[model samples]
Target: MILGEFWRGLKSGIVELLSALIAAGLLFALGDSAILATITLSSFSSELKSESVLEVFLIDEITQDGIDSAKTYISSLSGVSNMTVKDPEAAMDEMSAILGSDMTDVLGFNPLPFSLEVRFEPGSCDADYLNRISSGIALRDEVMEVQYASEWLDNLEKLTRTTYIITGILLALVIISSLFIFVSLHRHISTRRRDIVRNLRLLGIPPQSLIVISMMRAIFVGIIAGAAGVGITILLWKLCCNYVVTIPFLTTGFTVLAIAAPVLLALISLLISAGRSQSNLFASGS
Candidate 1:
């Protein structure tokens, strides 16, 4: 198929596959970007459970003065974004609302622990660092059990990792499916090889002309497939991830680049395939 064939299919294949190609393109963008988002989460230790302010288990205790001092120390640490110590009274009130009982009555003499909350900067939440801090505090006899929401952070990390893995598998499926579609279309035209040869022989046309025609068709197909895929990918990402991806640094531009880059590469691949098939036409003519 040449450029003329691409035009021929403008009404036929292009029109038919336009929607599907775009849809596939959108899926390709989402799945690929989803994995990136998840991987980014993993790369940043900010998502740690210790970062979570709420938890169900017993909390470690610290004096107001000691907690304040700890806060200052943690703040100075690299990767520490922010930190706070929620007083026992505040903790009790929050628990009271959730537990549906007067924390005063429920605890009687039991006092809510004066727990410290530390918000780490983007990179501070390493296991070694957290453990070092926890162990250092636990050694102080004045301090109760040192507690922060590490469990929730762990779960978040796992969830992010899982999302990336699933996205990767799905994207592989899309690539395979797209290649199958492209190659299948190539095969359909190739099946009419005898007729193409007979026609060329009768016209006394150069075999190179036929090759040019097929290659020209491939380029048109690539452009159509690429453009449709890119358009659909952007449209879908705008609709779906407008809010979920809240990072200020991230942009729709990356999403568009992600979609367009791959599609263009695929188009180039189609061009190469077309070139390869051209040799066959020349050989048969000889």
Candidate 2:
């Protein structure tokens, strides 16, 4: 009988229901997109960090013994994943590829210095860490200079931090706005059905039943809104993959959570709203 009243109430408030649904759906869609974008960017940043390498150039007069000693020392450094010694010839070839011409032929000699290309393990390198390692490497007797993209690393870190902050703010805004919409819709429905609720109360229908009815209706609206949100999110993801850089789709777990979160939020909102409304009803009835 309570559920019957819930459906009756739903059919009576079609306009209010549609308004809340659209509002919540758009908010959820935006939140999901932010989450997915953040995940993709973080993954991409990690891959780049893994590939980041420190270049240690050797002094011109360094002997083979010095090279071997340097290699052993660098290999023993903490977080050193791999190191490759690039001879002057190899360095020259790399420069040639970059310049699209043979630097050795132009200069009549390979002025490129021998260098050690060193990569660190994933999650082990950051701007400050690279700076410290490079500084320590430069202090070696046979080392000419140590170079790494410290600026780029700093920028990447900032970008990642900013992405998380923005995502957090977006989610907070969505939740707050969703709560407002839910409460407003609940009040509107209660006002419209006040007489019916009074009659039910006279017939011995407990106030708690009214709360349950409101919560159930909210959950039903939430499921529909969640579906609409996911649909919009999929469409946006496809557009991004087609025009922007490709990103991995949300996994099954994330997709399910994305759809379920709004429902949970809606249920909670109705609980709070219904609790307050029931309190008012009791006060008025007495």
lDDT of 2 by residue, 35-129 (tens): 88898888888778878899999999889999998899899888889999999998888888999999777788888788999999887777777
Q: List candidate 2 segments past 4 Å from native.
A: 76-79, 97-109, 206-208, 240-247, 280-283
Q: After superposition, how far is residue 101 of candidate 2 from its true place, in Å?
A: 5.2
The TM-score obtained by model 1 is 0.59
lDDT string for model 1 (162-190, tens) is 77677778777766766666555554455
The residue-level lDDT of candidate 2 at 192 comes to 79
Quote the lDDT for 116 in model 1: 59
